[model samples]
Target: MAPVVTGVIDAHVHLWNRATDPQPWIDPTTMAAIDRDFTPGDLERMLDSAGVDAAVVVQASNSAAETRRLLAHPSPRIAGVVGWTDLTADVAAQLDGLDPASRRRLVGIRHLVHIDPDPDWLARPDVGRALDQLGARDLGFDLVVRWWQLPLAATVVAAHPGVRFVVDHLGGIAESDDEAGWEAGWEAGLRELACRPNTFAKISGLAGLVNGGDGARLRRVVDVALDAFGPERLMYGSDWPLAELGAGAVAWRRAVDELVGELSPAERQSIMSGAASVLYGLGG
Candidate 1:
């Protein structure tokens, strides 16, 4: 049976108001479930239903304005904010420009590298310098990449040992017709990336990756992640509204409980909350 875990902190949740900050990537027809705005109240209800204690809200767009709005959002459940900054520009100046309170709330930064046109965008020298700035400021970088981009991400993670990296969505498996080929590449890249001690992986977004939200397939992926990252470097994230597209937050939480059932109480606690708390500096 799964060990009971309390004070669960979801490391990857997104909140957006489409009118102010648009998510152009969201296809209205296919992604009708999450087409509307997701308010702080909505987030609270979701967390309450899923029994999640708190969450780290992640930026959905590349806009700095969106990040500011998230930082200003009066959500008590938001333990940290992972905002976005222009990696090609003066990252330090832009981040330092934020007011002190906003700065305190900020824990990390991210870019939609998966949708970026440049396949080698993460490897750019300017971006590398910007990442160095984040490290200096004691901030983390969230890597949201596609399956094929895992190796590239691994290269960057290796180069920047100072910058803490949280690999979003198990590095994200591609929905390819050639499932075996893509899975092989993803696993190989993910394992290689895990070799870096500065890196961590989120056990979120897997429900959407598997067909029919198969529990066994999800368990297999989680097991592979455990073997590579162990419970210490692994964290749980609901991926929330996006997860609604898969099995919904409550179901995903239950699935995770089942997946990690064999782990000891302390190990389960690490994945459920401990790892994220340490990574994001969420104090007890």
Candidate 2:
């Protein structure tokens, strides 16, 4: 096979020590398969072999300590980390609780909004107040919301003029859904969200969205995101560990490459590496 694209960064991944940590979400089908820990060494080899240079290690749990553990791994492979925190918690106090170095590695904060589908959560007094504090701190927020919840997501973005928001996994589009029309509403919402200067999007998780390796489904999703967020605000992520639910590192890279097939070389590099480098403060 031709050499896989070099210097590509799998912007999102997770490196966990299952012995010390428990992730309740790993697939039951592969529980026995992935029950063992996956270390930085495991991830580095995947990056090296898959032609990926760096990655942003996102939190698999709502633990600040998880961010610290990944940061202490002593590997240059993890360029940044998108960690979890109770955004509704005492914002200043929670930020202070983070280890100094871990906070430095943080590119953004994320809460599992996918599990909490309530539209009012976006405008809830405490949640909205906490989000304002995030904007004051100049940190990004990764919106992990479902497709049906995207309209509320747009509302949240519209309300927060200063906070930078990243919509993950194309709003978690179901791969079985027809591309053209089924995507229109969410696409419209993304386009509306993009009009806000602070909102960005990630072109990741294509593998998990499909049931049987439907590349066409992935293509439609990518096209809409690229059209909405443009190359500048868009970044690529592997959603590893989670990505293992669908495919391995090598296969994931191929799918990402194929999705961006029509882009110019520089555009591909931005989605693959450049945008993430700037966002996460990971200098090349």
Candidate 3:
């Protein structure tokens, strides 16, 4: 029997205000559901309804100002912030510039590497140095990369064993015309990445991958993640407003609940909250 899930911690959620951080990637035509600003209040309501106790608010844009704003948010339900920092810059100084309270709220840093023109950005020497600084401070680095970039991410993860790495959105799997080919490549790359002991993955941002939210496809990806990282290195995330574009938050949450329902109580807890708590340093 599936154990009763006592709590849930969404490891990846994004909040954006267009006035400060313009999400240029969002198109009103296609992503009309989430084109508007998503504030802390909106997030709190969603979490409450989903029964999620807390969430790690991730950066939606590559803006330092946005990061500071997110860190300063007064929402007690926001467990931590995965803010942005320029990978090519002096990451240490940038982090040091933050106030003590903001620094404490920051659990990790991320960059929209998937959209960057340079595919080899993660392999640059300067980026490596910046990642080293994050490791030294005991902070995590969230890798939001395309399926093709998974190997590169794995290489970087292996190099920075000291830094806790969390792969966002199951390596950003999306709907592809060549479904079989896409799954094969994604599975291979994800499995290789899972070999890195310091790496973890989020079962988020996946409900939208398929046209109709195919239950079988979702299960397959989750199972692959389970086989690769296991429950200890896997965490749940609503991916929120973006999820609204797909199955909607409530539906996605229900889907995830059903997907992980077969695991033992301890294993289910790990995926639901334990993994996120440990990875993001969220105190009980």
Q: Tell me the tens digit of each residue's lDDT in model 3 across 1-284.
A: 01122368888899999987888889999999998999999999999888888888999888999999999998888888999999798887888898786678898999989988988999999999999898888789999998888989988998988999999999977566565577778899999999998889999997674438577778888999999999999999989889999988878888888889989999999998998877877743
Instruction: Note the residue pairs that clash in candidate 1.
Output: none
Model 1 bad stretches (over 4 Å): 1-6, 176-180, 209-213
Q: Each prediction's Cα lDDT score? A: 0.87, 0.74, 0.87
Error of 3 at 274 (Å): 0.6
Pairs that clash in candidate 3: none
Flag the better candidate by lDDT, 2 or 3: 3
Model 3: how far is 212 from its true place, Å? 0.9
Top model number, lDDT: 1
Please provide, for model 2 over 232-257, each residue's C-alpha lDDT reduced to its tens digit, 9 standing for 90 to 100.
87888877766666776677787778
Model 2 clash pairs are none
What RMSD does each model have against the real structure?
A: 3.7, 4.6, 3.8
- 1 versus 2: better TM-score goes to: 1
Looking at candidate 2, the ten consecutive residues that score lowest on lDDT are: 1-10
C-alpha displacement of 27 in model 3, angstroms? Answer: 1.3
Compute each candidate's TM-score over C-alphas. Answer: 0.95, 0.87, 0.95
Model 3, residue 155: C-alpha shift (Å): 1.1
